[model samples]
Target: MLDVQSGGILLPVFDSVRALAFVGDLSMGQPTDHSLRTGWIAARIAEAAGLDASIGDTVREVALLRWSGCTANAAGFADVFGDDVAVRLAMLEARPGWAEAREAPGDAAALMRPLAQTHCEVSGEIARILGLSTSTETALRNIFETWDGAGLPASIAREEVPVPVFVVALAGDLEIFNRVYGLERALELIEQRSGKRYPAFLADVAARNARDWSCAMDEASLADFDAALITSGMRRDARAELIADVIDLKLPWMTGFSRAVAMTALACCARLGLDEAAQACIYRAGLIHGVGRAAVPNAVWNRPCALPAGAWERVRLVPYWTARAGKQTGTLREAAELASYAYERQDGSGYFRGADARALSLEAQILAASVAWVALRSTRPWRAALPSDAALQTLRHEVASGRLSGDVVDALIAEAGRSVGRPQKSATQNSLLSVRETEVLRAISRGASNKEAARELAISPSTVRTHVESVFRKLECSTRAAATLKASAMGLL
Candidate 1:
């Protein structure tokens, strides 16, 4: 694998992307290895179809990342449909009544087109961020398109759609439908979608060999899929933030939640006199602690009233899923394990494993406390965000109740009180953006929509759009998440 240096440390591109893909699976309410299985199926299909070797590799990539854009439009899904996770799972499995539900409110095509556009754009940007081949990126941009020119964001169709797109689409269908319905039913359904979702020839290829492919996939190892990724790896400097950004997108109010927790945890680690290695572990854990959050539906998260017992049960399993997904990857195993403990209480009052203080490490204690602090300060649908002093009081209450460690709470509170100044104007002097563009960048980086940024700046939304386009051209980015990542890395925001 290639290496990219960040503060004199090497970051694995494959590891980071694979980790995000796991979260993507959770977002879609699927098992953690869904993408890996799809990738394997797509590669086999490509090879059997006598495609070029490079095209086969791209097919694998497109399959693995086909759902990477799910998180980008998660909130929109929640708005249109009550439970984003359940709706998406039904959609993918082609369950009865899903189409009716999608069209219940209004025109499904009109409602879905914008959401699809956002998903495609963000996913394509993710491919660009990983420095994947242009072909892979292009294929991903049209991931939802179909052979009949009827797909969402349907700008291209038929021969204009890349071969990898159709291959991956058929492979994904084989993987999901076959597993959900038996092999015969899966084949029947695929046949029904032929000449619509994909070409009839591709459906014929999959139907004839799906059973063998499914058996082979069941026997294949994770190593087999990762082998291709390692050989064609691309490195990047800011992979962790990519995950945090996508995770937060499930809820608009939760933008940058993980990064805030990580930064706070890092400061608390320093205040607690932890070693550098321990501090780094805590920081990374904070960034990914909410990976399990993806498994919980946005509707559940944004509930306006207290969750019922059943909903609470689902919420409690959030960390369980995080820990389970962690074991699927090597590089992220340790951090993900620690992240899974974010909710564990010192008094054995927390969820999903409910280990008491004696079972918790200091790093886990710090991470948990940091998550609590950040959540208390962030606004939620059920309650207004607590002020800093009030949030600190809540933490102290947890400490008094023997649920949080007093030492960790004190360290976090100390870090919270510390002040720092922003980088000087010189930091942006070389960014080559005008003052207005910089303002727009900073606003959007903070999760402001174009209209919100325009409202804040007392300008029209159209003007905001113009500035956003200009910013994209100047920064060479296509999505707000990408621009935000680049701006943060460059200290321009």
Candidate 2:
């Protein structure tokens, strides 16, 4: 059996790409998960139609990555089209030629000229930064291109366009029509685009295979699908790493966020005189604190102003989801719980449960301070990145307000003192445990039954029991609660 928590390590990366896809789909004026479902459906359709497995894989990857560039220029998009998310969503339902006119007049040339130019440039840059292959980048860049040479860059068309691009574009549009209208309306829309916006052959294939596509990608449980995919030979290590990467991709400022947070928390624990083993636990917990943000919508995440009351409530659930997901893995349960308090205030005003300072775990306090310091230095929708001095001042104010721990704030400020002239980016320290030990520890943290932990980690129950005993002994604890408390106090949670 594979370690479930280990499997989750990939979620951070996958979720990031998925989040970008969601943002792009939503920003383009489609419903959330529209693009994902389309990509899933496209891949399934290609497989069902006997396209090569590799082609199906590429199609799936391309579909998810197609709109990745949208979030890279979210602020810019908002500037050009007020309420960026709304404008893009509206574009999805707009009549042909109406989108262009909304921007300009019968001067179609001038009207679409800038939007197309901006879309291509921004989209390409985003794809490149996310480390996509050149071919993938090109396909993404040409996602808006038509069968005629009338799209952006004004050169590529028909056979000149990448097959994956063609597949994704056609599949996405068809999925949208099917959801909003019906089977007949969707086929009609595809027919309308047969030789212009879409390739006739692909359109015909989609129309012919519409039933299979619909059945395969309908509203099914993503959790079950993800499990099946994993069991069907998805590399556990790769999947975990990918998940981590996606979580990191949520905010540009958080590119290596989990690692940095883990490292910083460990360093802070060390500075406070925690033993090496306890510090290791803190570091691991820090690496996975934000895993739940994957479940939240990008609109609320990238909103420039105060969120609507309902949206704000949804935003607050991100931490709760993170903890819930972590609990599923068994190794990061404590870390997940602490992460739930990341947005919490010492004044007892945080989301989910708002335990005040006394009830807050030490790990939670350190995480709260660390996240605040890091976020202040990172760019966000509501503000620009703050200079170190300003960020420190803000942290100090929070401390004074009883929202952060005085000790942690002081330790972090002291850490900042050593880097007076250096940039204040987030950083991660080395892992305290060997790879195998970390795996065992992750399972232990989840409160996994010894037998279950053994099964999940592919080790004997006795071996798991031995490791658990060693873990408790090394951390100088007699029970799980004792170990958890010690870990939290040491900032390992």
Candidate 3:
């Protein structure tokens, strides 16, 4: 069932993750729905092949996570390949001979050498940071390893490799060929590569399971699978926060990024003396502002070349999704509307519903400045992270161009300086509520019942209930944890 609270629709975290993976696959050079569809296919194959449920679950996980590390070195890729998106698409189509051709002892070799090195190192780093299980980590590291030990660093041979890695790689390639070529051609290619680049047994398994694979490819079923896999929680608010983290994980440089932006927005709101409810809304909205990026392809996002018109249109849809995701939630609607204008220029140029300064909300204006500042500091395929001075200069340029408000820019610069001196705190602080209400809300945020909150706080269950009710009323909230997030944004607790 769709979870709804206070007229807010909350997508489950796993469902949200599936949405993210779908977005990543479509946006990046990987095949469309490749990871997720492959995951569904692998799960079915494992079931039919008599694997245990645990093994099937692991296979599914490995398939989803296998290519997650690809974005870690986007900046390096942009540097070596000129256009990161184009390079990835080419890599997808590169034959073994073509790959080797790029390494033939000259400028080509020098260029492709860094690309390969970055791919391996960045993949490993991303896997480690995401806290994948040891087995999952091993699978990601050896994903490019060939049966002949000709693939990449460490080049481990056939029998030494993990089974999930082998299965995932086969699934990924087969899906691509099936989409680009035909089903028959895909089968022929897999059959041809059996016992060479791919394991003979896995290839045979894929061929035998091709029909079932197609059955699993039904878009409706994939959506159901997403719903089934979502992490369970009491309210959508908790789920939303988890979704934010997953989205941020798409690129290594963006870890905890949305939270940072949200916090800064809240701080700015405080400095400006906005009301507590509006401040809370700004904080939550900031954390979710980049949710639309999931819909864009990784190639376009990391592209070094200027985007073509159609691709640029897709890029603009990101803000639309951000607003769309939050529109059903009353508390988040205003923030989402504001965030939709996050990319707007002070002079009126922006996208997905562009509005100039007169049309911009204060929260949106603040968000625009914060997002730009963070992007400047984050490594991208086109450029290295700028120094603070350079980032400031860029911000100043935007101001000059009327792309950003000068007041907003100045506030962000001040916030950036302050951030450097202090250890970063939780983006949502529990300060919006009073002490008693905060205590109740915190317990509620942890999924505590009124009775549970009372025991934790050493107060009567009735008193706890009253405080919970008060928190809801005071923060214009209907749920315990949303109130907690409000408190955090306000730094009251």
Ranking according to TM-score, highest score first: 1, 2, 3
- How far residue 91's Cα lies from its native spot in candidate 1, in Å, is 1.1
Q: Candidates' TM-scores? A: 0.90, 0.62, 0.61
Q: Poorest 10 consecutive residues of model 2 by lDDT?
A: 228-237
For residues 45-137, could you state the per-residue lDDT of candidate 2 as single tens digits?
566566676566566656776765454344334444445556555566545543442432355445444555445544444445445556666
Q: Could you give me the TM-score of model 1 versus the true structure?
A: 0.90
Ranking by lDDT: 1, 3, 2
Query: For residues 52-112, could you state the per-residue lDDT of candidate 1 as single tens digits?
Result: 9999878877777788888778777887876888888998998777857652378888888
- Kindly indicate the candidate among 1 and 2 with the higher lDDT: 1
**Candidate 3 lDDT by residue in tens digits, 296-415:** 545576577788998899888888877665533334556667767767777778877777889887777887888888778766667878999999999999999889988878877876
Q: All candidates: CA RMSD in angstroms?
A: 3.4, 16.5, 14.6
Cα lDDT over the full model 1: 0.80
Output the number of the lDDT-best candidate. Answer: 1
> Could you tell me which 10 consecutive residues in candidate 3 have the lowest summed lDDT?
1-10
Candidate 1 pairs with clashing backbones: none
Q: If both were scored by TM-score, which would come out higher, candidate 1 or candidate 3?
A: 1
